[model samples]
Target: MLVTAEGAVRIWTINLPKAGNAITGADFIAAFEAAVDAANRDTGVCAVVLTGAGKIFSAGGNVREMADRKGMFGLPAIEQRYAYVDGIQRIPRALARLEVPLIAAVNGPAIGAGCDLAMMCDIRVASERATFAESFVTLGLVPGDGGTWFLQRAIGYERAAELTFTGKTLDAATARNWGLVSRVVPHEELMPTALELAGQIAENPPRALRMAKRLLQESRTGALESTLGMAAAMQPLAHHDDEHDRRIAKWRSA
Candidate 1:
């Protein structure tokens, strides 16, 4: 994994190009968790862009490792369950805890767990060369890494069901049409587009951005009344923020 910062925006590149950027063992997850933890503590980081090192965004799990049953797949049923809980699952958990925005710059094919990984982000920007598939069924396995939940929320139940059941891939255009990705750009322009969007988001007051994201997350699972109540509760805090006052003053002057 490679992490770099551009002002308030951080970029995380999955750097295993030769392996099709597949997520293999626990090390990658551990590293991701560490990076996210560090970012959460760093007030300078307001937004993050996730992408792959090479042409392929991610192939998902390591097929070779699965075939050989040499890693997570090799453990006993109970141990394997524990492995997922303590390992790859940590990625989504960490993402959930991230208050800042995350943008997935899908540069190529995102398959199986890779598709789920992109779904975990707050927004997705796809390259024209990008494709997505929920292909766990093709491997005779289910989406154990929370793909079922994330996919359904991302693209709706029917579409998620069809993709998961058929393992059919959707091109960038189709994904945008389905609302799986917000935008599609040429491969060469993917990172710039993603960073540009992240920069726009990062331009907002940091505390307000985090609170707004929290509200969005709550609205996903909370009732209208509850969300409204939460919004009411947060309004005073926003009003009291010095950045909010500064922005208001600047707007008045302009």
Candidate 2:
């Protein structure tokens, strides 16, 4: 795992290209969550850009571990369920608690859990070479890592169901057509495009940016009055922020 900063956008590269960038085990989960926590602690960060170092963004779970029955794919259905809870499942939980927005830069193949990881982000951008698949069915398994919940929300229920059921692969253009990704760029332009978008988001007042994201999440499942109530509470805090004053002054001068 490697993390770098470009302005207020923190870029996270899943560095295990040799292993196809598979999010292999509990150690990887702990490192990933720890990185997320670090980003949350930094108020200066307004967005995070997650991508992979090599051709594959992530191959998802470790198939080797599954074959060996050693890691998260441990034997016994009950232990396997608990293993998911104590392992890969913690990632989505940590992401849900993230203070800033997350942007997925799908550099290449994002299969199975990798696709679900992208769906967890606030926004998604794709490289022309990017591919996506909800492939748990191919392995005779299910999306135990919140894929069912997040994938449906990203696209629609029908589209998500089709992908999950058949384990179909979607190209970047098709992904955009299905509203799975915001846009697709040349593979070489992927990071630049994602960073430009992140820069636009990162320039806003830090506190307000986070609060606005919270309101967006609230509006997803909450009532209209509930979203409004959160906005009402957040507005006062935004008004008191130094960035608010500076922005106002800058606008006045302009």
Q: Taking the tens digit of each residue's C-alpha lDDT, what string does model 1 give over 159-235?
A: 99999999999999999999999999999999999999999999999889988999999999899999999999998
Give every collision pair in model 1: none
Give Cα distance to truth, residue 188, candidate 2, Å.
Answer: 0.8
True lDDT of residue 34, candidate 2: 90
- Lowest lDDT sum, 10 consecutive residues, model 2, at 66-75
Please state every model's RMSD to the true fold in angstroms.
Answer: 1.0, 1.1
Question: Looking at model 1, which ten-residue stretch has the lowest summed lDDT?
Answer: 22-31
